[model samples]
Target: MKMKISCKPIAAAAALLLGGCMVGPDYHRPQVNVPATYSELPGWTQAQPADADAPKGAWWTGFNDPLLNELEPQVAVSNQTVAQDYANYQEALAEVKVARSALFPTIGVTGSGTRQRASAGSTSSSFTRSVGSGAQIVNSGSLEGNVSWDLDLWGSVRRTIEENSATAQASEATLANATLSEQIALATAVIDLRTSDANIDLLQATVKAYEHFLEVVSNQDKYGTVAPSDVVTARTQLENARASLIALGIARAQNAHAIAVLVGKNPEELNIPHSAAMPTLPTVPVGVPSTILQRRPDIATAERQMAAENATIGIAVAAYYPTVSLSALDGFTQSPLGGLLHVANYVWSLGGSATETIFDGGERSGEVAAAKANYQAAVANYRGTVLTAFEDVENDLSGLRILAEQADALDTAVRDATHGTEIAFNEYQAGTVDYTTVATAQATQLADQQTALSVQQSRLLDAASLIGDLGGGWSDSQLHDPRNPDKPPAQPAAASAASAPAAQTSSATGQGAQPAVQ
Candidate 1:
């Protein structure tokens, strides 16, 4: 003979799985009102299109500074902020795994062995009568296994996993943002240090020139060709130049401290040589503005956060439906230890249960409202980030253009000062002008040279700032780039090369077409 089993449970599970649909509005990228072209302004040149296929990783390498290219990776590997974000990303991934596991059944095993004496009038005494004993001692042992599952009839488990997976992606973006930030900081700090050093050199040369002038005045005073008061005035000018040199050292030290922090080292452990390592500004290609949405890690992070929030709305809505659970157990039991193992001693049970929240003083409604509010907040934040990113790129563009013009003007000033000094020296040698006139002209010449150096440094810094604001040419490849989270690692050579702007053009601008985030 054959026994028949019902297929009702299997059919029901299949129906639930097939019928379930996630509830919530699917994510839609917000439509932003962007300009066709950046507004024309004084001293501003239009940005040119960059090559789409060119590598945009390790943008700092475009400066062609071997030391900076070497140090950039170290900042990404060991920077404390990047490490924290990397750990958070791992934790989010683990949460996704945990959430995904909820779609399956849970199984547990239990076993017990016991010996007991029964009283004469106890319920077990009736069964003992068949064994011919007034009072009986029983030995019992049993092993049981149970299975429980909550069928995702409404896709609750699937929705939960969806929410967590989006969170994990957001965490990954955050890590990339942190890495990009560290790289930018290190590059900018290095630029600042170099600029400071150049300024110091300029001031040192000025101080030496002033010292020589002071000596000339003192010698002339002894010969009565110059007054004693003139000698004092010259000494005072020399002291002022020395003071300026001392002040420049203070800024340089501070910049060095900042660089140490960027590289994840103690200030005392860092020692940059006094070489003229000023970075050369690269001709950056302006990709489309729409690429900023995909290229900037922070913007990507904001977009992912919106996706997670959207999923949360579904999770909250799921709470309004009834929860169904199925449980089953199978085992054996008997009065004697040996009998418990017999085939006839088998016992089994299966059941289903459900629970619904009929009333909770409006608590469920309130919870749903809160979830909706959270979703709205996330949307607003994402939009705000998009706007801010646009502003930063535009501001940097204007700064670079205006500074270039200023640098040109300063170069002219240096040329004129050099010519004036030559003319003054010739007149003084012919006794047509006094030594005081030549001294004044020489001082003017020194000031103009110093100003020119300062302007050039500013221009370099402005260029670095522009690159940093544009995300340092960080590419999507480095989004998953495996740098040691615990310590800074060197950027790859391929990334460095790819980061260079494709073509040198004065009329280039970031591209205007937007890319999809998902």
Candidate 2:
């Protein structure tokens, strides 16, 4: 004959798995008022089909600098700040695992031995229930395995996992943000260093020309064809040119130091070679403004934080409901040592328990309120970040637009000034123009060239900054979504790209990581 199985435990398990309802408001993406089109968008920046999608790694390659292509990858691997952020992301991932563990039962094994001489009339209720007091000396031993589980009848465990999973993803985004920032910073520093080299070359050329002019004036003085004071003025201009060349050393050194620290190297250990070639600025694709919500890592981080805090609301709400637990013990016990081995000595217990907080005056309510407030703060921060992203794009676009115009105008001015310098020098030799007038013209020519160099540097730096503000090629799906409590979300296309340097793809298709979600 077959024995009937108990239905009580089976029913309890089924109810725990099926009957619990999730409490609290499901997260909603805050209604941010994104602009239809960036008001400050410059006409020069049009959507290029080539840049329509941003690729993941090696954005610096767009500049086509072999050195930048080599150094940009180092930022992800060696930068100290990126290291810290990466460690934090690992910690957050561990926390997600910890929270997820709560959804399952815990099992423990226990063994105990006791030897005692009890008084004939002992009156301890707990000890009396488990042991007898008939004899003066007695020994007892037992071995047991216990299993306990808190039924998630109010979605508490699921909610905790939801919160922590999102937090882990937010931490991942933060790591990506750090990596992107330092890489771009290094790129800009490299640009500045190169520009300094070019300016130094320009100054050396100016000094040589000034020395020749001084020689011409000194010969005129010796021949008594010009005032002796003309020699003094010419000598002074040559000296000033040399001094300006020397002053540039300070800026070049500082920029070198910044690059060293950024790449996790000592200043003395790394020395960039001097070069006069200016880096070409790439046309970074300005996708539609709405893409800001999905492209940037910091924004993704902020948005994930909002979802994490939103899940806490339900966790706090779970506290208001009674907690249900199931516990079971299976063991062997006997009063005497030899009897403990007998099959009949086996004992077992199966039970359920419930706990409810009868009075805490408004603690649960206060906790719920605090969770809501924190979520609101995250929402505000997220919206603010979105607005700032738009501002960054607009600023970059305007920089490119206005700077393009300014550069064109400076080019014309430099050409005109060069012609003026030639004319002024010819007139000076002919005695038709004052030496001082020629000196002033030479100064204007040098100033215009230096200004043009600086403007080019500014444009390069601003172009990189605009790319950083555009989110350094990160996606929101890279982080876990809390709303899918029971489902496995598909991994993001570039999920592995963040941690794998070898996975770096060419910027051929905007970089190679993948186009971010629209």
Stretches off by above 4 angstroms in model 2 are: 1-19, 41-49, 52-56, 114-139, 480-518
**Which lDDT tens digits does candidate 2 get at residues 1-518?**
11122447655675677456888878888888887666554222233334424344567866777778877888888899999999998888788778866766776778788877766554333333343546355567777777778888888888887788889888888998999899888988989988988899999999999999999999999899988888899999999989989999998999999999998999999878887777877656555677678879989889889999999999999999999998877778766444665678777788899999999999999999999999999999999988888888778767766676578799999999999999999999999988889998999999999999988888888878877887666656655544344666565544333321111112343433321110
Q: Give TM-scores for every candidate, taking all chains together and pairing residue i with residue i.
A: 0.82, 0.85
CA lDDT of each candidate?
A: 0.69, 0.77
Alpha carbon lDDT at 32, candidate 1? 68
Worst 10 residues of 1 by lDDT: 509-518
- RMSD to truth, every model: 7.0, 7.4
